[model samples]
Target: MTATGLTPSTQGAPDPASQAAARPTAHHPARAPGRLARSVRRNLTAHGFLIGAVVCFALFSWYPMVREFLLAFQKTERGRTTWVGLDNLTTVVNDPAFWQAWRNTLLFTALALVLGFAVPFVTALVINEFRHGQGYLRLLVYLPVMLPPVASVLLFKYLYDPGYGLLNELLRLLHLPEQQWLQDPDLAMLSVVVAATWMNMGGATLIYLAALQGIPGELYEAAELDGAGLLRKIWHVTIPQTRLILTLMLLMQVIATMQVFVEPFLLTGGAGPEGSTTTVVHLIYQYAFSFNNYGAAAALGLLLLVLLAGFSAAYVRLSRTEEA
Candidate 1:
């Protein structure tokens, strides 16, 4: 204490520890490494997860597609590769089988849409109505889809045999004339479509069944109140509700049927009678494997790609227009 003051005030003085705590320290330059390391680790982890898929797509899908495009313009002849320019395209277009293959592919797509699209929807509708055994019925329908494709095709071949096939036998028993199923040019494509529809329709049928189950029962009741019959109810409520799914399935069926090769190849020996079953894909197979002409095969494949792309674009445009 001073003589004139009771005590000296420490209120304005700063604490040494507090001042030191608040003081800014010099930059170490080491923290940058720590932050950079953390960023690198995070990026590495993310890329590690993505690398597998990237590699797989690069190896299997993208590489093959790019190779096919290259093969379209290049030719391998007598252990030498040479650029053929548009010669391969010209050759593919000029081939007599090319147009025939397109025609057959289109026909197959049309028939598949009718049978594959309609049969599944109808089957789903019928199955949806069953109050009992729906699960068992669905299982039965899906069983064929689970079968080995080769085995199914072989079984169909035997069943389609005109001489001793069960179908002809049934017709004969009914006093109907036995008809050649796959052997006749006129019926071979139809036979293939029927078999394909039977084999592949299970998944579509189940999808439609799910769609049907999602429909509001109140809508059906309202429809009934309006005096709408069964067909009218289907048209007014069911079909409209399921239109999107139907359109998707229709596009899927078209693509599947257009690329059809295994069924017709195994059923009617690739070319069918008089090349009636020679679809575009089958023709491509013949070009690549049978004739050992990769360039021609690629060219034909490119053509099919263009056609399908155009068809899909037109369909989407039309759908949007209708929606608008």
Candidate 2:
């Protein structure tokens, strides 16, 4: 539009058509920051706790994991870090002791799970059926868990004493040949497994007991009406109802058993009887501290981590499937 609000030809004499052709002047009020400022403040306050938590997680958990990975790929000598590619992992993989430790750990895990898992469930079922002294039985089962691992392992060490150990003495009294519990390599893992099973059964027992109580009484009543035997009722009703919990506990037990450290560390004093009781965590300790090879230790730790993650993923999938 021209100054006179008309085109050049109609400038002098205003053309009604040209004036009508001019575009409308558009107005937009400038925005105030009040609403935006309030929104920013609300977001800042709401996420303040979350931001702090994330920072702490990064500073501690994430940083340590990443550092361990870096250390796994690099070797350190006299305060100097040198990139060694997969040398650390290769050394760990090539070590002859690795296979033995793996075997021992797996054996311990299988035995522990078999004994530990079933003991609690059976105990829970029996005790749940009982009419009296339930509290005392639960207390007895949990009592060992309250004892310090060192104390408990040490106590078992006394009991496993070949010469005067109560266990051997009992066997001797029963007209049975005495067997070395902790001394013999053939029995050392078994001995530790028994002790670990005893010490750890409490937690699983408590969880299963709680789950058992949560089971609906109607199921049992219906099974009774159907003339189902005790075993059949357990197989059909109890097992299915508690299957999720049993599966979860099984996976958790696997993870915890894989990281068997304190028990063997104290019981066998770092891998028992020619490393027959050596576990993966114990080996990692020996590598990182005893041999002072942080790289190999870190590499082995990363391997253990991968194994745990795989187990956990499978557990999650199985759990979700059970839910579905």
Candidate 3:
């Protein structure tokens, strides 16, 4: 009925779909603000947590390191602080105990690697072979790690007592001559290493156990099919599979053993018979608290820090190269 040859009502009226599409959407402005507020609150909360962590690290860790670096160059005497440059380093180097401490520390590190490093891996391997009671075994192995460190050290001290100690009693019962465990200078460092290994190997054992569990069974089976013995399988399959973890553990063990303190400090009173157990950290303790030479302590600590940092850097670089 119109110029287009359609009904007038159809021609004049708007399409329902077009009107629906063209009309402005009914947005809930309240919802938009609510969402924005929630997002801002979340961001603020996350940032607050991040800021708290950063502040804590800055206050506790970074500030102390910076202070130590500054203290290494400055000396406090008679309530007056003066910059003494390399005097602290010279003093620490000149101390008679310095070389002795370094020697003892290196010896302890070697001993610990032989005992502490190998014992845990062997224990883990043994435990991993068990088909049952794995959880109980793990708990038993980790029990020592759960004990308070001071309590454990005291316990070892009691056990090391030459007179009527359990270890001495066992030796006597077995018709073996009872040796002075901690009294003799030759035995003192070895006794301390033993105690240290017993105290710390629990954690390492669990870590190795976890690494061993992650190795696929197929490799072991293939190794068995190749007529490999237990030792051979361990060497070829197990070691390769856990090579990364072993490398990491080796580095950690070296670092930890080099910083040996608590065991020697508790077992032999920081300086064992004839200064045999005098470690680098023990020397630092002597310098700071015993000798009241904070500058010397800081200088010694800086040397240790640099040595450890350099070793860690080298280790990381080597690991990266191996991975590549």
The most accurate candidate by lDDT is 3
**For every model in order, what is the number of clashing pairs?**
0, 0, 0
lDDT of each residue in 1-324, candidate 2, tens digit only:
566656355438866777777866678876669988998999998899889999999999999999999999999999999999999999999999899889988998898888978988998898898789999999998999999888898899989999989999999899999988777899988888889989888989989999998989999999999999999999999999998889889988999999999888888786788888999899999999899999999999999999899989987987788679
Lowest lDDT 10-residue stretch of candidate 3: 1-10
* C-alpha lDDT values of all predictions: 0.92, 0.90, 0.94
Superposed model 2: Cα runs more than 4 Å off: 1-60, 321-324
Flag the better candidate by TM-score, 1 or 2.
Answer: 1
lDDT of 3 by residue, 1-324 (tens): 566666345766889999999999998657677899999999999999999999999999999999999999999999999999999999999999999999999999999999999999999999999999999999999999899889999898889899978899999999999988989999999999999999999999999999999999999898899999999999999999899989999999999999999999888899989998999999999999998999999999999999999999999999899889
Q: Each candidate's root-mean-square deviation in Å? A: 4.5, 8.7, 3.2
Listed in order, each prediction's TM-score against the native is 0.86, 0.82, 0.91
For model 3, which pairs clash? Answer: none
Q: Which ten-residue region of model 1 has the weakest summed lDDT?
A: 1-10
**Cα RMSD for predicted model 1:** 4.5
Candidate 1 per-residue lDDT over residues 9-126, each given as its tens digit: 7888999999999999988666678899999999999999899889999999999889998999999999999999999999999999999999999999999988899999999999
Sort all candidates by TM-score, best to worst. 3, 1, 2
Residue 86 CA displacement from its true place in model 1, Å: 0.9
